[model samples]
Target: METESVEYVKQTMEYSRKRAIRTKLVNFVINKIWKVPIFYSESRAEGISSVQSDTDFMFEADGIFTLSNEGQIGLKSDTSVVYVVMDTHEVHSGYTRIQIMEGDWNDLSEFASSGDGLRSLCKTFGNHNSKYLSNILVKQFWETRMKSVIPRQGLKNEISSHGPSTVIRYAADKDVVEVDTLICLRGEWPEVAKEWLERKRNFNWPTKELIEEIKAIGCNLVPIGHRLSHGKELELEWRISFSKAECLLIWSLNGTQTACIECMRLFFQVFISPKFPDLFSSYFIKTAMFWLIEETDSTFWQPLNILACLDRLLSKLITCVEEKCIQNFFIPKNNMLDAKAVESKELLDVLRIELTRHDVTGEEKWRMLIKEKLLQMDKNDIYYYHILINSLSVSRHFIYNSIRSSNIKDSKDMLMQGIQELKCCNDKDMFSDVCKQLQHELEAILSIVTFCESQSDSGTDRILSPNDTKWVEETLNKYTELSHSTGKLLLCTFYFYIERYQEALAITEDVQTRYTSQVVHYTFWNRSKTPRDDHYPQITPRPTLNETLKNYIALDVVLLPCLSRLFRATIQEKLYSRDALFIHPLFYAFFVRFHCFYRMQNAAECEAVLNKMQTFVAENMDVLKTTQDFNILHLGDSCHQLLKKHTESGNYFKKTIKSLLQKGEF
Candidate 1:
């Protein structure tokens, strides 16, 4: 019997823990490490294998928490976490592979097995699973679309590129009771991003209409790196999909097609897999089956021809290993066989000999066994087997009903309806729900506005009308209950955009604080001339004093951007005073009294602020490098230039400032 006591098991970087770990890690990095203050990337979560770090590295971490602009705790992370990130340094763009910070898996699993969790485990959510699974499939829909468009004139370049592969890690099966995560890429195959333009019917609301659309078009593509095509460099791309197309195609067959694929998988898993576990992977045969089916007509896949299909698929894999080439169906340039080519060839040769010896004199032992066991076999496919999905898919009844009742006609109609709904909704009881709906509608509007802006940047379209921007600002800021960190940032940005500088500054106050995180450092013994690894003595504050000061400097730098120039001197005075409201005791207290003086037409004070700015930069040169959160991409070079210019142009800067103010450039 399992005890009530929650025994904490050491976390590991295992396939079973990937999804949970990734969720936790993303929370940790976004809140603590990267401190992502502004831009967002839903297009992340897919990457090459190298981003992963040791499980121990993450487990040792005591996660840091972030405060919202209100100075309230924002998002926090459990120790067991993993993150998917881009290739940017500070590791900001990308995420570490597996970072396990904290969590009691024992109690959680037991809790999951009790009452509510147990009840949820029994519910059916097939439609919901398929609905959510569609985002990663968007690229797939485009593939067939592109095929037809390619033959049309002047369309090739317009649709030259494709994106995404299905991230199956976030998907689920029908029987799964736990809410399994499903992520599919050209790595998330069909993640259908919401558009700037709304959909006709269920436009603002979540609906089944959206689900069908995703099922039709979402997909992901692989990045095989760049190669020369003609005289120009062309990116070589492929796809890593437990393919919806193949599943749909196989389903389209008359009968027993699913059974045939199942049989082949069983053959590999039961026999071939044991012989060469690493090289003759279960996927090799299934991949071959998908390719063969794609090439053959529907007439070729029948109940009677199941055996033939299986045989042909196996032969195809054998040939692929022999030739060291398994071309992807869509992207012919991608060679799937390269990684295990040599090993697969050796295995296939050995298997052929083994088969010949065992099945002599008309004894088809392997074939007979596979066919007989087909019915009893579970639906074992790559997508289902490899993905870390929920046991139970969440119910979307509310969204379904909303879309059903609204019956929106098109994007424009949806937008109009949303506007009407917002105007009518005044009840405080429904505040949170209403705010969420409003935010979605606003996001839709913003996407279109941003789209037009991007087009303008590329000279293809004009900028959005001022009315469109005003509408977005109004909509985005209407939610008074919006306490989310991202939402607060958006609110601050909205105030900034509307030229409500005072409001923007007020909103920024909560972010102006001292923040610190614990990092472990170890001392090592110097053996010979090299070094012997060893643990450093544990100290209360830290093993080193430099790191602590660095935190103080970093916090100060973050607040500097939002600081009022007039009060720069006041802040500088309070730097060492206990009256400060900031977190870090040494928050940047540079005297900006000069700015206030200049604005007040007081020459003496004006000169002081500039001197203080220069002095402040010079004094903290050592800890300045820690300000990665501020996005001062090349702070070192830029700061150096500013310091040099300020020093050299000392007196002349006063005249320049006066000119700037006279010209209204201030």
Candidate 2:
């Protein structure tokens, strides 16, 4: 039973490891788009998939430098640059006070010079003539600034402050994660941590090469002050954060070690936190793990001995609490524990009881805890589907944000790599099946876009050759095998583009008859609820995608003959909108149908199709009004104009079609 329980725990950690890989892959794409220094922190990035964990992100402040001394600010004397010199005198260990050295006050922004900002935070030392920036005041200002800026970006979450970070607590109705973002300043490696670099170790958990790499990465100054500081020191001191280094260290841990850390965190959160409230923090648990890993032999940290490891870690935690001192891993002089000695004793009592309940061995007690948590979680196919869905959702978000701004080729390559990695993670499950379908859809979209680009390059008389038509048919067949409505609609557009009116009209009529609410539209967003189908009953909420939505194609798949010229003109005129490039599948199907009728000189059929489209639009106006679903008004007006022309004069309608085709415009 012990071996089985430990194996189960290890298996659970594998799930989390795969999740972390997927998240990192998405983050790699996001980092490319933002082109800034951003770090994902805490549980999500650390391979902990606990539902209770909040997503933490840190953005390094731009144009800001933290130097060890004024001498280091040699050539950065430009007015646009802000520099602060770290002062370690009389400060707590693992903390420093930064003094503004050189920069225009305006560089800090208008708020910094205002009475409510830095002016209010200024304080003169008793004997010194200079003033230092107050960590507390900086944190407060950033919190206020973030709260104001976030709502402007359309995130109306409830924003509040926690330490140096701004917490965005999403409402229950919102399908978003709770996020904590911190604005930090990068600095050179702190002198206090030099000892950790050279510290003697019995077991080299983080090898010398790792230490050197971490040193090169340096540290960041968080806005929060040391908790143990008094008087003005409390407001002026900044804590030295090794968040980047800590992340690297956690990533270096083997499977067993990582699983042990997760279990320690879970134990603390589920068993200890509710009873002991603020006596200790999750950081204490992490810090203890670092020490435990360094002190124990590497061979002992294996899968079969996870329970033993957890027991040893628990013993370490109890020792720390009893001694009332949990040393910072990087700076040993800094005790992380507070002065709540009585509470510590009580917590130690609880830990002792839990570790040896009913005369149970410590390893047996830990095995029971691991088994209990695993039972509470949905450790089945559903969990794997959730990971796959989240990965696809993030990838979609990346593509949506970068489609217009970044290179299309890079976006496609990244998405392909992501899908491939996801397939490797779960080869025989629903996860792999969904990935395969998505891959096919992506290839079809790419083929259509490539064809459009070829047409644009070949210029005016560019008509589809026999080979091109055959390729289109093949792509459409493949896509249709996976998705009927979207694939057939795409084929219908291709037929209209090639002037095959009867073929296009037949496809539209067939699609209209078969279209239902069950047909999912390809869009930038993913649906929260899956379609109620008999397939994949094990994964209730599986994600589905119809097309690889890219900016290169107009209207999801339609690319006009003069698209390049028109796109350039649109960009120059600043008349480009995402709505112009994308339309709902239903709207697109009707739009193509209306054009087909206009081309064939069927006034009655055009009018009838226009009325049906308008009716559908009218019925969903309220819902459409809330979202950017389909620009029904825009498409409806275009169809109405075509209908008007068909009714006015057949000769003039024929002339209109000739003029549009001659101009190579849609």
The candidate that wins on TM-score is 2
TM per prediction: 0.27, 0.64
Looking at model 2, residue 614 earns an lDDT score of 64
Per-residue C-alpha lDDT of model 2 across residues 1-666, encoded as one tens digit per residue: 657656666666677666666556455535553233566777777666553765777767666667876677775666664666788888888888877643446556323544754445556553755677776766666676654333111123346677778877531111434578887778888887889989899998799899999999889988777765678878778888998788778778887787777777777777667776776777787899999999989999877777777778888887786677889999999877654453355666665565445234546556766777666555333243445445554444443333342333554554455445445535532344445655665566566556655665688586657886788678877776555555677677667777888888888787666555444333332342343333224434533332222211112333222222322232222214441243455666777787788888887888877767766665654434333333345556556664545432333334444554465432
Off by over 4 Å in 1: 1-218, 222-244, 294-297, 342-363, 366-666
Lowest lDDT sum, 10 consecutive residues, model 2, at 546-555
Which RMSD values do the candidates have, in order?
A: 24.7, 10.3
- As a whole number from 0 to 100, the lDDT of residue 511 in candidate 1 is 31
Q: What CA RMSD would candidate 1 show? A: 24.7
lDDT of each: 0.31, 0.61
Tell me the TM-score of model 2: 0.64
